[model samples]
Target chain A: MDLATAGLKTTDHDGIIRIDFIERNILDEANIQLIGEGLNHVVDAMDEPKLVICFENVEHLSSAALGVLITASNRVGSKGGQLRLSDINEQILEVFRITRLDQMFQIYDTSAEAMSAFS
Target chain B: MAESPGHHDERRDSDSSRSGVVVLHDVRTELDSLQRAVVDGIRHAGYDEASTFAVRLALEEAVANAFRHGNGEDPEKVVTVEFKISDEKVWIAVEDEGCGFDPDAVPDPTEEANLEIPSGRGIMLMRAYMTDVSIVAPGNRVEMVFRPAG
Candidate 1:
């Protein structure tokens, strides 16, 4: 996906799609909308898609960003696909833990770990 | 969960030497400058990364809540943002044009049943990040403060 259009770098490793955020801060309202749509497109493109959202480059994100992730996870799960999150920084991880999203999502430390976990 | 305990209604006498109040009709157009006004002041006051993250998240959520739920997504209605940044803490309050609701009536997003719901987590995150987060009643206005650990 185009970086500005999606704020993401999506690559296929075998059949698993690993998506990386190109923007350091994912807090803007307009950009977050683009990202939500882009992620939905990726999830809808494949049958039982296994996706990895790696936050290795993201420095900050607001609650709106988290909402998009939950939306993507729900959409993919309904289609029998799987989603994993990886490389989230401590600050962002705290946001997840506080909201108990850490319990709701499959979080891994690395992209490879997430891919492997996708059965 | 609800808010930081016990200190909800007590506003600080004076914690910071600098402050600003910004009123905007469309949050989409104003969020960047609004962010800079608050974040730059916090940085200038020498707060750490964690503090900055906490303040920024709370600020964004509060402003978005004012824009969306409070104003009902109407661009013509203004959102007023007031901020004070000091060496000890950053205090911000965002007020909307519409009538308010009870903050306590909002459901907890972290509960097992509500976990899958995407939208209700804004207030939860604000309460989590801010040292103190409270809604000034009639509920259209939220006041937040984040003090860096010593």
Candidate 2:
């Protein structure tokens, strides 16, 4: 299922799914649910064992959105897959750094670098 | 930006010259609008970008806690939010109409065992982003302050 119509764009590179946000901020509860669903769809459709979420345009993310990301990361991990985040803004990066989530996920400067890690 | 009209009661104290009060019901959907209002007020007060972001993060966490944990997501309850911004600092208080918990008892999210847990990070983020975070009025109210970085 392509969740791009649902506010998220997805691309598959050799079985590694890269999900991008069409919106700037995933702060509200409804958008969080949509992002979660998009992630779950990507995870469920994964023919390979890796998933990458790109935050290229996401500048401000609420903690509720962080909760969704955490849940998605755990879900992928439980399935013997990996989740990576790339191109996160500094402001958003500060949230991850403050919460120490930067230590949990493999972060890259760009989506290309993140995708290349799967090789 | 001027205040957006909604169901909530809003008051600005012209005498004090630097305060705004917004009382909102515990409706989850209102969080985004409330956050935007607070952030706008802070920015309009001449706060720098970093300071505004800090205040925004802290205030969001506090209100989220009031709605989620304190009010248990009950829409019938109310969350009272008051903010005062000055050249020195921004002070915000959020009160919920539900039983409150001990802030000290919240597990540290940065701990090794609690890293993957999703729930406990709100308080930690509030504390980390704000200059000071204190539970007042017998834990029913959270008061946070953010000062401009020197």
Candidate 3:
């Protein structure tokens, strides 16, 4: 699959940007760049009270990808927003489990569920 | 087989019964999903626990290194991974078609300045885990071997 076809989008609601990423295969700099760039766009606007990044369709995630997620989460958290994830598949979740990262990030089963929590 | 432990000898006999390699391509988007296929292909051939883990760790490190460093954000580079399992060990090779780097020149991560960094650990991890590790032909090839213990 092409890197960009991974599905990255964001929406602004009530001054909060909700970034969604759908990735497959090995997530590296190229794919994470999509997430980074999208988040940066929202961060630049600085109009959001909170931000959430929802990962969907991502099957396998590498440490490199995790690094990017952590970086994005830190950036959002520093700006008074939160970087959250939802719809994380089982295979991808195994990596998080192995690394004990499940406790480090807020995860949800659906984007609506995550957004509702923010609301 | 002649000098191995009782169960291990039998295991070796069983292992020799099936041995081969699996080739996969275009499944880059589903690496975890493909892992099962790759792992199963090796274990089914009768590699032991330690050997299997060694091969798996090496493959993970190499493929990841290729995806991040060699491919360099290009999905079209076509990272190819192949593995061969035997009674005594497993050999895994990951091939990437990108500009190469000098492996010998990499700064030791154990050094104080690089200890906290994430970028240079893959190769070190592979070397630490695999029984034999080598970079071939301008870094385009990585061959690792996991020898069975006793």
Candidate 4:
């Protein structure tokens, strides 16, 4: 099923939410703020949110976008949930590695792997 | 010449370097076009994919920092972006209208104790991706240079 919640295009995969960002470049500050708000709303609705965000469509993202993801990850952890990032291109993944966010977030090679890893 | 008020963009191509000066008062409408132009310049100058990504990411972080932190999101304030794209390297500068702050005071986001902090990573990202990054005194302006990987 497709979900229009927040700025995300998500699908339900056996209760695991597979998320894809609507924008190719997730850079704009205002847009990042909106995505963060949307994520908070989704996380609040779930008792233990298990989400897999695929970056197949994302070409460019700024540090602000990473901040939003970190905030959401903290919220999910507080609620005993899990979040996974997958399908990140090499260059974008380098951004994660540079900031050491790779250690904080679980990343997978594909969305399917990310979804399967969710418990 | 520096241009401000509404939006002004001046582009020039020469044997030395291709220069672009943009003064953006409305970030929402103007920022993306500027990025596109920069990417196009990099492509035209035959920069590799990695260099393109590095310059583009650093540019985004710098510009966003100027708009959000430096300009304080004031619509009346303008952010200025200046760039010189060359065959071997790319140089960019982003300036805001607000008074600058101390960059050293920005804690390292990668520190073990501060891993979960949601912000304060822009400067770090710029420094990581760019070959050289410097903030002009007063801290309102940042200049970065990225040389194609050899």
Which candidate number maximizes TM-score? Answer: 4
TM-score of each candidate structure, all chains considered together: 0.91, 0.89, 0.52, 0.92
- Candidate numbers, best lDDT first, in rank order: 4, 1, 2, 3
- Residue-level lDDT of model 4, residues B34-133, one tens digit each, is 8888988888888888888888888888888898899999987888899999898899999999999899999989998888998899899889889999
Clashing residue pairs in candidate 2 are none
DockQ of each: 0.68, 0.62, 0.08, 0.71
- Chain B TM-score of predicted candidate 4 relative to the true chain B: 0.92
DockQ of the two-chain complex in candidate 3:
0.08
lDDT of 2 by residue, B1-150 (tens): 132434544454454225666776644566677777767767766787777777777777788778888998787677888888766778899988887888888888889888898768888888888988889756889988888788
Candidate 4 deviation (Cα RMSD):
2.3
- Taking all chains together, the TM-score of candidate 2 against the true structure is 0.89
Off by more than 4 A, model 3: A1-6, A26-30, A47-49, B1-60, B66-82, B85-90, B94-150
Q: Note the residue pairs that clash in candidate 4.
A: none
lDDT tens digits by residue: candidate 3, B29-84: 43454455546756777776555555665577788777667777475556666566
Number of the top lDDT candidate: 4
Candidate 3 docking band: incorrect
Give the alpha carbon lDDT tens digit for every residue of A1-119 in model 1.
55557877899999999998887875466578889988998999989989999999887887788889999999999999999999998988988999999999999999888888876
Tell me the deviation in Å of residue A113 in model 2: 0.2
TM-score of 4: 0.92
lDDT per residue (tens digit) for residues B73-95 in model 1: 99667787888888877889899
Comparison by DockQ, 3 against 4, better one: 4
User: In model 4, how large is the Cα lDDT of residue B74?
Assistant: 95
Clashing pairs in 1: none
Per-residue CA lDDT of model 2 for A26-102, tens digit only, reads: 54554777777777877776643587788987767777778888888888888888888999989889999988889
